[model samples]
Target: MWRAEESKEAYEELKKKLMEGLRENEKIESILKALKLFNSRKDRIFKEVDDLEELREKIRRAKEEVIENLDEYIEKAVKKMEENLCKVYLAKDAEEARRIVRGIVGDAKLVVKSKSNACREIGIVDYLESQGIKVVETDLADRVVQLLGEEECHPVVPAIHISKEKWSEAFSKETGRDVPPDAQAITDASREGVRRAIMSAEVGITGANAIVAETGTIITVENEGNISLVSRVPPKHIVIAGINKIVPTLEDGLNIAEATTLFGTGQRFGAYVSFITGPSRTVDVGLETTIGLHGAQEVHVVLIDNGRRDAIRDGMKEMLYCLNCGSCLASCPIYMSIGEKYSCGYFGGIGLSFGAYIFGAQRAFVDGLGFCTDCGACSEKCPAKISSNDLVREIRRRAWERFGLLLPPHKKIRDAILETGNPFGEPPEKRGEWMKSN
Candidate 1:
């Protein structure tokens, strides 16, 4: 389990992990190699776009509009979904979300899930496990994390820090077989494990990549086909997503999904995109439509607020525009050094801002607010044009205001500039002395 960011113990542990992560040459080399591969695919995505900048601008404007009028859009989405014979619930926080989910799950013994960072954001996995529900993750990376009992290191690649040998060992233990230390072998084992879990599950829970307000459809994009099986095979389907994920129309939702796929994994499109509009229905038996004819009988959507509305009120509204594409994580130098151990909640640069607002400013500070370099790489790669560097700087200023925490070096430099009018602590006349000789 990941430690709480606000605690002193967690702060100390984060420092230790950061040091260890930086010095591990093998891990560093693996991550750098992954980065190279990602950038190569990312370049190809840009090459295929006719007007990437125009599309980005359009998405930015759309996101801003949606966030600005979030309440109205949510209301519209709920109404439309209910009209499609789907149940909808609004949760103000994590606790409320978990409670509503439990009610929907009722007497379910086994639950299957797809890849969903939003579920992590609400602590749903832990909550369900505590309630005695056997929850299984179907995503390959998520499955690895589950078996290892480790926190998700990256949003897209949850077990990116784990090597192939480690994964092979985990799979061998899970299946009670001598598994080869090969990528395909490990994946095949995971597929078998997840398929069994899905077949036994009574309830299926997932997070939506995008929610269409006009049609009340939930859209999910994935490379693995697990999401498809989990949503279809079960008798009950539940979608838990943030209120900010709602878009005005299906077209707008697809646009956002396309950008997210391109920026997240550097793909032209996801391998599988599922558009679900409610429970499964068939009219073959008679003239009337029959629910549960092939797929799920009931569909439930829970939209959680969890400090997001408060974030807007606090002037950190721009964060709501994030597509969770994870491009920012790949570009962050600090993230590359410390991995996800320094993460407050989400991954990489944007996590700093998310930590401040969602997890609290004090927690975020002790969690490593000063680590950011204020570089604009994250901003440049963001599909929605969010300036995460600026957000980090803003959070840094707030940290000082709230807790008076400042790096000793920065404090000394500021003091020197104030006292001697030079960062070198020299008189103004000597400021150019080095330039004269060198």
Candidate 2:
């Protein structure tokens, strides 16, 4: 489904997915259940914030400062990381990123990966698999999605649509036995599977929460504790991140962590937060330095730009301010009906913004650019407060400008309005003509 440019195949596939998601389905019920749980407790989560606007504003401004000066920050961060003995590369796009990672892999059989939206964004799993490299997902939800042959529905909870029975089925296939469809049983099985994969893998891959350019620190936040294991157990760790993840300081990274949990999971913070700088090292034995004592011996960070640079150049910088939080989708009416299939690569109006730039404006139309109602719920719930609705509308306008195919449905409505004074094409007269019904 991933291509350097727009493809007819991608459009048709996404259109089919859009129709499937719109119908009544168990995934819709499951998504509704998850959103209900999230909605019920979000008030308590936000109530703890002493100065809500101040916190949001501060975080936004700090990130905006870095994004505005991303080139400088990336340069400084790359220098610092290289000084810390980590291999670094600036990948101009997804293909270059895949090529760099493939070179690092060099025929390695197993690569264990933690939860990473960036990895999904660039389609690394399929790429590696095509090269005969077996990539195992150490994260439980990601494992389930892989087993089910499904893509993520939400950023925080990728397997929200999966039920306990489905979980057992997904794992039972791997075990070749009848595992019980119970929560504890599923968790135990998944944990064992991930442990085995991590223990045997030669390389580990991860996405970033934020990168502190001042100290060359890469921060990853999670609750499952798999990120630490995946990043450490393997001899080599490879990190793929968007350039937008760069921040000026560790304090900024920590703020991003807080915002991620607050908006995504209604928590003040996640249970496990990992700040990795360079490879593992020690200097304890006779004051002699050694590396790879209990963690990765080598670390590689790939800073991927894709279309982000062009997006900024075209005045679409707000699209990069997303935290990948699913808060907006929880309230998105279109998302409620269609789940993640509404958008091509990701979930809601905000996701459409990213898809538009990365996939192209014409493909964005097929990715459900017209589905958004400009409700503004996304902006209200967004921690970054990036007017995603407005951005999506702007992308739709661009789609129309580029292809002139985005307005046929709207043209029909317009014609109906002009002829009958109603969008529904109902017959109409002057103002007093409707009194007959009463």
Candidate 3:
């Protein structure tokens, strides 16, 4: 799937389709609508709180507490998890993560997955499927894009750019059957199909929103209950998550969850928030503890680094602090205009730099860099104050040094000024030709 020819063709086709469907006026309308909804929801959520600033400060402190003693917290969590009969593996990178999962899921033919950016980060689905596992995405948006053989276009709402009309068409094409374009019918059809997949899945995987070190529990919040179904019905469940998701306590996890929900989906809380400690167990009939009553019999937590530790060591720890709220995607003008093809695995301003670094800096820096308009809206709304614009510039500079890519357009304008002493390159005297004293 990552072949150069296929990747290039896919990129070109995506760009053409997006450009044709998303005009400047339509982009403006979408942005306005999204901003209105986001701001209204933010206001409603923040209105009842007595001291918003205090809450933010407390959350920041909680994050600092974890970062200051990361190792100790991880050890504590591992020990607690082991006591709960849950297997834990700490992966130094993507390869290690893949190995750990493969060992646990040996010979499993069918696997179902929740919508996890982390899985995409490690190329989990593709790798497992290549190894002869039939992997299926259970999330509605994820399933839609996967069935269409397309990459995700947004971080939070993966298929928001797809209209209901197009969704119906895609469903019809994929299913080889006539499907109505009516919204309710389309939704029901998709849901029923995925429901069957979830029930029969042998192994289920999900991403962690937050991990409570104190309780050794992982939390996942989603609008659809698919994640719960996947994690519960499957015989084995694996949670692939970044190490930085660990929090010091359950309260801290809850606080992070609330902020993430408001920032990500413009909701106070998601429809389902699953806090799983270990496999489901019961001691009823014979007074013998038996696991897998209602939930997965075996649970594994794979803590993946995959360059995150290196990013932290290089002083990019703030990026690790992200709750995956995806607020930046909603607020980014570039993302609103172009959709997921431009953003890819990660979305919005922050994703541009991180995705490029992890995926391929040269390609991302040159192709994805120009997508951003240097609009400050994303940074302003970001809960973490991550300077995404600055990171993009830095990545572009590195790309030029490493791969000899072209400088960004703004830099070219600046270079012109330095070479000719005038940004316009016209005669200095002619600079005032258009000026008229009123």
Candidate 4:
């Protein structure tokens, strides 16, 4: 949505941030540690799978089928969820999604939320705060970033930039106590406050890692216990997720979740894997089921289309296969250098593809597409086998076409392509000259 000048300025600012990150030893160390963990876990997964290639093929087929049948699956999901006592809303865009959530959360004073990238994309927290609602982030990493007023540098670990020493200081300031510079101490301090907030909050919100259409379930994968608390404690539970997250069946959703966890942080499985069908209910009384007996009395699932349907229609169908594992970010030299400080919406090479639609070409260009090396490292590590480097190059080509700002070398290449049907500048008649000479 940024103008040309604004986009250009954003690009320059991103370059500055990259340089700053390169100079920060602590940040570099953190990235290296994450990379190490990722590699080790990847090796384990490769060894654990009995048929690696078969699994990849199955997953690829499954994802393709789901995307192709997205509309049908969504309809089924809505019906099944409603039958389970969960209200469903289809949001056409970020603004509409936010408005729908606002209407559902009307007059609620306090809300607790888990780490959901969808929430960030829709700007829900800021909008809610503007309307005088208090929202607390339950994820420890999310809490750290929220307290410091910084964006998440990584999908799984929001506070990757914060060192233990600095994090302890922040926690101490937040808690008004001299918290020790230890991981446990900081976590304990945050947990104590968040626990109270969760219990007293009027509503809880989360993002779905995947949705099962047949079972009408929302699947969330997390390493922390925060999401469990966030989804259960409040009287109302809301899930906001992109339409692309829907799968045909619960098994398919689990497969995606497993791959996401393995690739996301090198974990064999997430510490917490939650599947919510609807409001918590019990069939203990005379074999008759009662809704909202223990957990949230009301459940709402807002499936957001936003720019995803447009993206699929506009020839970016493969981009929707993204699992949001953050593996591409870990593998991308550009992402590792600059972090996600400049990405308009999501982060990493896959983020560039989504950005082109969700944030516009100008913003996507400024986000990091111009600086990509096109080495295909990201695609190699991607769980879904998305060619992120190729996507970035295509976006760049589109940018060049629309903007009409060609460097001299690019102009020459364009001229050659137009003249010879290739960038080599060879005439059609001379196509076989090289073979003859050889």
Ranking by TM-score: 2, 1, 4, 3
Listed per model in order, the count of residue pairs whose N, CA or C atoms clash below 3 Å is 0, 0, 1, 0
Question: TM-score per candidate, in order?
Answer: 0.91, 0.91, 0.84, 0.89
Candidate 3 lands at a TM-score of: 0.84
Evaluated at residue 301, the lDDT of candidate 4 is 96
What are the runs in model 2 whose C-alpha is more than 4 Å off?
A: 1-18, 286-288, 413-438
State each model's CA lDDT, in order.
0.84, 0.85, 0.75, 0.83
What is the total number of backbone clashes in candidate 2? 0
- After TM-score superposition, the amount by which residue 364's alpha carbon in candidate 2 deviates from its true location, in angstroms, is 1.3
Question: What is the alpha-carbon lDDT for the whole of candidate 1?
Answer: 0.84
RMSD of candidate 4 to the truth, in angstroms, is 4.7
Query: Over the stretch 276-354, how does candidate 2's per-residue lDDT look in tens digits?
Result: 9989998899898799989899999999998899889988898888888788988899999898877757679988888
Residue 337 of model 2 has an lDDT of 89
Residue pairs in steric clash, candidate 2?
none
12: Cα error in model 4, Å: 4.2
lDDT of 3: 0.75
Q: lDDT per residue, candidate 3, 102-212, as tens digits?
A: 998898899999999899989899899889999988888788888878656666766654567777987787667877888777777788678878888889999988889
RMSD of 3: 4.8
